[model samples]
Target: MTVQFTPDRLAHRDDPEVSKITAISLSGTNTERVMHIVVDLLDELGPQTPAELEHVYRSRAAVNDWPVVAFYSVHKRVSQMKKHIGIVAGTGVREGGAERVQLTTDPLKAHGKITAHMQGGDE
Candidate 1:
């Protein structure tokens, strides 16, 4: 089966997940920043552990003039993006194995959509 993605499909009002993801309330708490960083890192560095993500976030935050984000906060934002936005996908292991996260769709397209939404623009 093929899934078709279009502006109309993405704007479907009945899809609660999409609505939540596209909501114009992502400006605070570094949520949008984390999303961009995670997606960009996944594209450039491939799947990364939560620890690696925290390190990268700190580094990038300094360079980008954004506030430092905690690992738990990063994990929570990633979890929300995965569950509500479907931009990220990963598996959880309970036996002390590091979780790996990667982008589920085209990185550039996903980033653009997320950035636009975060900036209060309907994409």
Candidate 2:
């Protein structure tokens, strides 16, 4: 099924990958850091479920020379960024208490900027 996203639902978002990706991409000096993580995650699972993304974060953190705060904060920031840009898709809970999330349609297009805050080249 096609997942739909709306402003209200994004208000108290829980998924971190989306927000972290968006924030880092928007960060003038942190795009490389953000993109590197995102590219790795994307490559590993194509797109990911929220739980899977969390696992990816922990694994990457272990392998990379990044601190825990840096890893988690980036995840949270990317999630917020995703909400701001209206690119977040799916709700946090499914019928069986499972969380669901994935990159939005046209991720490459929607992913250009975390929000409309700036309109420039893609990260």
Best by TM-score: 1
Candidate 2 Cα errors over 4 Å, as ranges: 1-28, 39-47, 62-75, 91-98, 115-123
When summed lDDT is taken over every stretch of 10 residues in candidate 1, the lowest stretch is: 1-10
Record all residue pairs in model 1 with backbone atoms less than 3 Å apart, i.e. clashing: none
Query: All models: lDDT?
Result: 0.64, 0.47
User: What is the Cα-based TM-score of model 1?
Assistant: 0.60
In candidate 2, which residue pairs get closer than 3 Å at backbone N, Cα or C atoms, i.e. clash? 18-78, 18-79, 19-77, 19-78, 19-79, 19-80, 20-77, 20-78, 20-79, 21-78
TM-score (C-alpha) between model 2 and the true structure:
0.46
Candidate 2, 104: how far from true, in Å?
A: 1.2
Worst 10 residues of 2 by lDDT: 2-11
Assess every candidate by TM-score.
0.60, 0.46
Candidate 1 segments exceeding 4 Å error: 1-29, 91-96, 116-123
Candidate 2 colliding pairs, count = 10
- Please give the distance, in angstroms, between residue 56's alpha carbon in candidate 2 and its true position after superposition: 0.8
Expressed as tens digits, the lDDT of each residue in 3-113 for candidate 1 is 333333333355455444543333343567677778888788877776677777777777777656443556656665677677877755322476787788889888877
